[model samples]
Target: MSVQIQAEEQRYSRQQIRDLATELLINVGVREQFPTPLEEIIHYLGYTIEEFEPDDDTDRVSGAVNHRQQIIYINHQDAPRRQMFTLAHEIGHVFLHREQEANHIDYRDGAMTPREQEANHFAAELLMPENHFRHTWMTWEGEPELVAATYGVSAEAVRVRADILKLT
Candidate 1:
């Protein structure tokens, strides 16, 4: 059976979310860079990654710190690219939402919530910085793969950014 997935209505600009992510990382002492050392930064925030079997009903999930525990769980039964996005998404919860109160984010089937959308934007901006992505793409003489590689993201991501930039 085929399923329908809805494209989320964006509530924040790429610039706004990027700025918030930058501020969060800076407050945590993560130096400005491509693919910021998220694991390390999260560690400093007193969170750890744990593994569990996939729910079959869900792609991956994350657990936030609750009570006095300092651990978060991420399901590894996913593609490398998806695993990367999931991890970034969890980091999104850590910075953008109430971690101490919320315990889990079952980011299954690209779920949508206002908060999840915010996190998605944060992840996209963090993975693909707008200014850097634009500058790098401008240098690209029309090579999508080249630009995607330079930014360590998927070609589709670069393609979307290009569309957003009105480059193609």
Candidate 2:
């Protein structure tokens, strides 16, 4: 799916996005920095990450009061990194786009909604900041995999960030 990043404002820095997500957690009565695994973050907030063993068409979903307590539903068959991205994507929804009333993002093979697009942008920027990402990419031979591996994300994500930086 092609995400339209034109509408996204550059006003907020990546640190600001991270702060906002952290602030949101605090406002919801959760103390302490939400952990790194992302799944642990959900659990720390009193949610559960469950596996939908029989479902094939779904990637992940969040369920809880106001999704405050989130449940990350994923297919067990997905790759480790793909599942991590799924969790990060849902975290994008929960922290960034939930105010727009989005939930249960099914993996689509086509176009993305504007909100989804924005969330994807937010996710990329949050995961891989332009300054550090560009520096890392520049050190490489313009190979997306090298940078993606460094960021622990997909090559496409690296490409998008590189595009934003005019590095690719």
Candidate 3:
């Protein structure tokens, strides 16, 4: 089943977004894996990923998604981890907001509307699934850096996930 069918409307609670992300991961055959294979998942969902260099070096734009064309564009200058997050974030937009907009762009400014928040939550859950992340957190003794490395995400991302998960 497509992620779109799982949602009856555009507005979703955090739990609903998490469930959608988890369901997508399982549908893509990505259970119990660190650094979820976003590329493969995108392909499975019939989307393409393309990287483009920004005209300005200081551009804060992270990525954009064109749902009509099924293409996701990421800033080539971003670190691999950032690109991964952006990719996941775009995928979240694809599944969650496709009906709301034909295209969506993301910025690194940290300003989040409700839809952006839902997309961020989906990205976190997709990349670091709660069950696997919790087990890894315990295995790593609650060290965000180690968990981040294992998950192929930034230490800050790990810390944020830990905070969201209440991992102490």
Candidate 4:
């Protein structure tokens, strides 16, 4: 019921992971750098999304994905934007950590490894792509919150993306 990195068998650079995620979006016909329907992309990749409740003590586990079954579950209590991030993060694991996922490793250790960090980058990129984010920023005239609303992502995600894209 959990998808995890197995013993860190494969180490992917954050950039590599981000490239893969962008490639996936392109493969799914995302030709524009705009707010993509993260749910539709997940479904297109054969993933089904559901909402669940997590205990207050479990902040590390916001969401979980089972790629073999093509299912993703997000915490119901999380902010909508947080759930979006979790979904995109899980999508990162689907491609970046295929082997460990194929072996059915449950990533419940709550440790932040290169893989997890890469996944976070992937999530940020997927939710807010570089070029599209830049354009959106220009449209909003430097208001991150406005960009966040249009993209259905968090304001923090927008700012982080802005920093990554050197727009800040």
Candidate 5:
């Protein structure tokens, strides 16, 4: 496909993933509930969540989902918020990209593949739906840290959510 076509396809894929995430959140009662029980949702979906240290020579792989094993492995070195977010991101891949063979996402601060971006969007929606996030952002005096603490997510996540909801 041409670059424009590829971009359009990716955009469509990401939107579908977002819709799925929203549905899952609502089905699990997390969309209306603060501090979404994301871990519980992951377990409810029958995926195993595990932690491990990355080998010294390789890059810091934040999370990986092996479809054959139905397992998610999160890096132990990351903060709690990142770990949880990584798990959500991996969950996104399994559910949203079911046709793909497999892919391990690197949680680095740089360019991301279209699939990686989709997973990130999935994670964000899973953790903080835009409507709920905006309500919380407005009611909580716009304190990202306070909202983050309430949601058990990183303040940066809240900031990004705020920006997404155009609160920033």
Candidate 6:
């Protein structure tokens, strides 16, 4: 189901989204885990996760969350690292955009709107908290591949996050 962002929906600053993600980590008691256990978080929030193969090969959809049913649906065909990011992105919708719609389906194509941008920020912060990411980057000698493995994210994700964190 396609979800629409409400015209009067509240928009959060990137910092606010990051803070929310951090708070969620602390609340879920996964703040110290190198690779955040997204499934655990989903369960803690009383949500179910299911994986399904897309009917269309060209479908750019990655994941979606149905707040009303408390389920997060992920593309089973994606790589493990991609699935992790998609799960975290869906969780971001649960926290930040659930009020705007019952179902939030994330498409990988097209330019992102403000809500999508916020969700992406939330996912990045959720998957790779700033302080831990910084420590890991230094410990790994600034190797994106190593950091990506450590964080269960893509190497590109690590690179982008490093750039965002201004980690030399």
RMSD of each: 7.0, 7.2, 4.4, 4.5, 3.2, 3.2
The alpha-carbon lDDT assigned to residue 28 of candidate 5 equals 71
Instruction: Flag the better candidate by TM-score, 1 or 2.
Output: 1
Model 3: per-residue lDDT, tens digit, 1-168? 456644434578878988898889889898667778998889998999989888775387899999999999999999999898889889998988888788988988857787888888889988898888999999999988899988888888888999988997
lDDT of 6 at 42: 94
Arranged by lDDT, best first? 6, 3, 5, 4, 1, 2
TM-score against truth, every candidate: 0.71, 0.65, 0.90, 0.80, 0.84, 0.90
The clash count of every prediction, one per candidate, is: 0, 0, 0, 1, 0, 0
Cα lDDT tens digits for candidate 6, 1-168: 233434435689878987899999999999988689998899988899998888875368788888999999998889999999989988888888777787888878856888787878888999999888899999999999999999899999899899888885
Write the number of the candidate with greater TM-score, choosing between 1 and 3: 3
lDDT of 2 by residue, 32-140 (tens): 3222256555665465676666344443332212364456566566766566566666666666655445245445453586546655655565466555667778888
| Structure candidate 6, residue pairs in collision | none
Give Cα distance to truth, residue 86, candidate 5, Å. Answer: 1.1
- Cα miss at 149, model 6 (Å)? 1.0
Candidate 1 regions exceeding 4 Å error are 1-14, 28-32, 55-68, 99-101, 164-167
What stretches of model 3 exceed 4 Å from their correct place?
A: 1-10
- How well does model 6 score by local distance difference test? 0.87
Q: Report clash pairs, candidate 3.
A: none
Which predicted model would earn the best lDDT?
Answer: 6
**For model 4, how does the per-residue alpha-carbon lDDT over 1-168 read when each residue is reduced to its tens digit?**
232433564677667766887888888887464566787788777778877667666544677777677777777778888777878888877767655655222244567877777777888878787777778899999898899997888898888788877888
Error of 4 at 105 (Å): 10
Off by over 4 Å in 5: 1-15
Which of 3 and 4 is ahead in TM-score? 3
- Top model number, TM-score: 6
Candidate lDDT values, in order? 0.64, 0.58, 0.86, 0.75, 0.77, 0.87
